[model samples]
Target: MKRQLHSCALAALTLLSTLPAGAQHAEPVPSEQRVTVQGMKNASAWFKAESQHFVVYSDTSRASVFQLLNNLERLDYLLRLYTSAYGKPQPLESKLTLTFHKRPGALAQFADTPPRDAVGLYSSCSAGVQGAGVLLAPITELANAELSKAPVND
Candidate 1:
């Protein structure tokens, strides 16, 4: 997991380096930077970590989960920079929910129409107030890969 996070950060930095020198820092608001982590009511013993744009629920260790989330934030920053420059920036109406499941088929249970042998799943409800965007991932499945190949699973 550390290797994956390291590679993700390195890739993000590499992308950042390619940006023009005048790039502005994409800092989260002070209030949004505050993080709250807690255990959820589930058989999987899920932990919830919420920040500015994402709310992650995982069965992984706190340190590793935070590391994964940090990479996600970095990607969001890059996306925002790109959208602001080349397209209409559509700010999120609510935080996106990301859940990492340890078991292979666990993620399918959350889907309205479960996939056939899916490694992960994503669902979004456009009519919902928050848009209800969610990403479900199989952490154990992805963890088997080497650093260079790790992100390909994502």
Candidate 2:
């Protein structure tokens, strides 16, 4: 009886060890989709906001989009100022488009040939059509809504 119990326990252990690993960590893969500027514009649920230098489309709150756009404009100005010393300032013919997704999986669907685990995507157009210079990113939601407000630009 003791020998039979030992054999059964060993068999159960071997069977459990042969099972596939990481079953709990598996996630449902999102269906592949092509993302485009027009596609984003057609997404009725998305909110749109525009600044002097950025055209943002996001599913996040309007306040957050506006705040992000303001910061982006300020950063663009600073970068231009720094680079001006090196060469003549080249002006942008059109405002850049930024598409903000609510989650990383959503952003991945829009990325152009993205890696298996991409967090963000940025594409620069040297001489592309208007609105072709697009960026896809996930919004980092703040715990407090007050923190999303942009500082007043004097």
| Highest TM-score against the true fold, candidate | 2
lDDT by residue for model 2 (87-150), tens? 8855755777777665556654555566666545667666542221122343343333444484
Regions of candidate 1 where Cα sits further than 4 Å from its true position? 1-44, 86-92, 112-117, 127-154
Q: What TM-score against the true fold does each predicted structure earn?
A: 0.48, 0.49
Task: Determine which window of 10 residues in candidate 1 has minimal summed lDDT.
Answer: 129-138
lDDT of 1 by residue, 1-154 (tens): 9999999999999998895789798987654232344574434455678877888776656666676677667668867887886777556557777776566567556776666666556666775222122234422323323544756443
Error of 2 at 101 (Å): 1.0
The lDDT, on a scale of 0 to 1, for candidate 1 is 0.62
Q: Report the CA-based lDDT of candidate 2 relative to the real structure.
A: 0.62
**What residue pairs are clashing in model 2?**
none
Clashes of 2: 0
